[model samples]
Target: MGVGDVSKRILLGRKLRSAQLGETLLPKRIALPVFASDALSSVAYAPDEVFIMLSLAGASYYVWSWKIAIAVAIVMAAVIASYRQTVHAYPSGGGDYEVAQVNLGKTAGTTVASALLVDYILTVAVSISSAAQYAASAVGWLQGHEALFASAMVLLLTASNLRGIRESGSFFAWPTYAFMFAILGMCLFGFFQLVAGTLPDVESADLVISPAPEYEGAVTTLGLLFLLARAFSSGCAALTGVEAISNGVPAFKRPKSRNAATTLLLLGMIAITMMVSIIVLAKKMGLRYVDPREFDRMTYFDGAPLPEDYDQHAVIAQIARAVFLDFSPGFYFVVTVTGIILVLAANTAFNGFPVLGSILAKDGYAPRALGSRGDRLAYSNGILFLAGMAIVLIIAFDAEVTKLIQLYIVGVFISFNLSQLGMIKHWTRELTTERDPDRRGKIYRSRVINAVGLSFTSVVLVVVLITKFLAGAWITILAMLFFFAVMRAIKGHYDKVQLELAADEDDKVLPTRVHAVVLVSKIHKPTLRALAFAKASRPNVLEGIYVATDPVETNRLIDAWDERNLGVPLKVLHSPYRELVRPILQYVAEIRKSNPRGVVAVYIPEYVVGRWWEQLLHNQTALRLKGRLLFSPGVMVTSVPYQLRSSEIAREREEREDFRVRPGDLRRGQVDERRDPGRRG
Candidate 1:
């Protein structure tokens, strides 16, 4: 195999046949981690953002943390209930976009798609950036280079995903479960300590929180309501990755919708429990948090300013350290798994974005390239595109989770609201025709669940836009608009081209005659081969044409042609400006104009070289002539390849490993046992 091919195989494992796609479907155990990690990982930062927003009104407002968490949990539960109906109704894995389009209208569907697309990109950026921050806190040496670390992690995730969903899901499944256990275990132990009257304060408990200047005197006033709204909106980030499960139904094993709905229920219950427990634990332990950018506001209990270089740990880090005070290993384990899961959280977006992109492409709303699977049966183009956009965002924000978080929830909420509304419409439409009492009752219940979900999400959407528009949510809105416009333009272009390409009766008829012209560089083997191939085609007329950049070479060619007693006439067009492409184009145009109803065939000889560098040494003139001849009407340009000796290298590489054995393929029924090429004859 070529070096590039070998490298790709090593990185992405192996190329699977399209028929083997069934083997890549995930069971519930693996699907949970693959699609739910993003929502679960939000526990690492969503609570922190809530505290940061509340800190604007000082430590007194920290009491609202648990309340906001409960509100978020209620919204999440409704979302899960709503999506169960969605999965059962739309098992094709179009998720919110499909639901909105089919029930609402094309406009609503495209808007939801654009919203989901933007949110998916932000999920990767925010999750990776948060992980990088945790890495810096754990290892002091990585403090200033979080952006580089985060970008590297994005690339690593891209390579894993390029291997296909099943492989990458197995790779990430452990860390996700570990993260779940770590947080839940920590919470359970903390609650045990509280009951035993031994719960201790976190490391930041004693720091005095200084309220922001504008809100310093507003704690007892109406401004507190506005501040609480901001905090609640930030806490709602836990809902970011919930829609992924609904979008990923097709990736599940048999009974795809049931398994996906089960996964969503498990995700919602686990996420809600962990998020609420952390917020309550942080409150009971008197943990104080402020924006790292506003570190000056944090002070020692004695009214002394904290050190400029003081490192502020994330909420999970502080809780881990205090909960496992004596057991250093437990603390380290929690910290380690938390960071790893944060990085793997982006894997959720990795899977969702590519599948959704393929759907969009198939619908003609995106470029056709996104619809074609690579040799591995994965949407490789979509994966690379997601990684690249995430990297740009990471670099732009300098891997600051606090800054990236502001732009996060708007898109997710937009999709959530629209999706819930779509489900309501779907059930209403179904109820109109169903006469059976049992099915009608079931539809009634599903509709009510979606109605509740729509109400919750609509409220959350309004709060998000009101509180976050100026902060960074405006950027996401603009991004959604940009994607919407681009998709519409792509669909328009595809429609136009489709109409133009529709064949008519005239397209099926053969041309009256064929006039063949062979471009000869000299009286040599390649020229002779081109002439022989042209004659074999049995054209009505045939001639040899040459572009003369030099008179001496042109005269020598004429003498050589006459010496060979060739019956075909040779014509040389002089190029006073020494331009090869222009002279050849003029000659082809004349032939096409003279016989308007006939076809003019121009054959050019090209060298096929094996090595990359050898290709640059030949075929420059032939390539230029073909480029110009293609646009001329009724003109057919053909390349007659003459293989050089080095071309044998490519042939050898192709034969050396013509058949590869992908482990487990045969046993899984993905490969035929008797036709296995790796077996001994």
Candidate 2:
């Protein structure tokens, strides 16, 4: 094998065959973390966002934090319940895109696709940025290097995901489960302390919170309602990954829909439990989370505003510290797992985006490369594309969760509303074809659930637009529109190409004449092989064409051509500038101009080297020539590969590698059999 191949296998592990796809189907334990980590991990930051938004209206608004959490939980439940219906009905892994496409028509489907794509990108960015914040809070050296750390985390997640989904799930499941246990345990312990009248105050509880300038003055009822809406919108970040389960239904084991629905219920219950617990514990511990930039205006108990550089711990971190005051290891464990799970939260997007992208590619709305599986049977290209976009966002926003969160939930809610509406339409359509009373009743019940979800999500979408459009959501909207336009343009291009290339009676007619030209540099074995292959085609006319840049080599070539008595006549084209490709292209263009209806075939000899670098050293001229000749009408370019002795090394290495056990072999029932070709029984 080549060095590149070996390095890839080492990094991404071995390739899996198409038959091994079933081996990658995730069980409930692993699939929960794979598809729901993002939603579940949001408890770490969703509360922080709620508190931050509430702090804008002064600490007086802190009482509404739980209310907002409750509202978000309700919306999450409705969305989850609605998606359970989706998985059972659609079960094709298209999720929102398919539902909207099958029910709401193509425009709505494209809209959902664009929104979901944008949301997936934002999920990776926001989750990694939050994880970087947690890292900086724990490790002093990482404080100023957040963007670098976040970008590195993105790369790390990308590499892990490229290995395969099931592998990534196994790698990430421990941290996700540990994070859940740590937070839940901390909440339980914190409540125990509260009941015992021994609960300790948070580190920031000593500081007083002063409202922003607008809220510091008189706060009217309308102003209060607006603040609550903003908080509710921000808290909705918890629901970002809920739809991922529906999108990934196909990745589950047998009875895929039931498994996906069960996972969805578990994801919703766990996320809601952790989120509500964090909010409650934050309230009980007197924890305050605000954008640190606002610290400059906030006052302390001594009636002085905090300095700009005063470090602010996250809501979960403050609660952890307060809850585990006597146990430092517990504090570290909670903090560590929170940070790890926050990073793995991006894995949800890593799993969801590529599957949706593959669907879009199948529908011709995305590039066809996204539809291809890598060596590990994973969507490696889509994973890398997501990572690149996320890294760009992390660097652009400097890895600040507050800045990224403003752009997070808009797309998700947009998809949620459209998907719920599509489900309503889907149920309505199904009722038309249904005759059984029990099935009709079930459809009616599902329709009611979807209608409720649509109503709630529609309100959230409006709130998100109103509260966040000026903050940063406008950029997300523009991005969605850009993606929509790009997809439409790509679809148009594919459609046009398909129409132009459609087979018909006119394409069946043969050309009137064929003029074959053999591309030669020297009369060596490669040249002789090319000439012989061109002659074997039995064209109406054949000629040996050589581009002469030096007089000495041109004369020697002519003498050798005569000595060899090559059956074809030799034609030499002289170039004064020593340019190889342009002169050859000009010659081919002239040949085509002479016979418009005739076919001109140009045969070029290419060396097939085992190593990648050896190829770079050899095919520079031939590649350039072929590239330019492709644009000329009535001309066909063909390469005759001449294998070198080094190729045998690669071939033998491949044979040996092919017989070896690969990843997922056991799960796929791949039994290894070694048969000796040298032995005859």
| Candidate 2 ranges beyond 4 A from true positions | 307-309, 659-681
lDDT of 2 by residue, 155-207 (tens): 99999999999999999999999998999999999889989999999998887
Tens-digit lDDT string for candidate 1 (275-340): 999999999999999999999999999999999789888898899899999999999999999999
lDDT of every model, 2 decimals: 0.92, 0.90
Specify the poorest-scoring 10-residue window by lDDT in model 2.
672-681
Residue 631 lDDT, candidate 2, scale 0-100: 81
- Give the lowest summed-lDDT range of ten residues in model 1: 672-681
Residue-pair clashes per prediction, in order, are 0, 0
**Highest TM-score, which number?**
2
Candidate 2 has what TM-score? Answer: 0.97
Tell me the lDDT of model 1 at 669.
Answer: 60
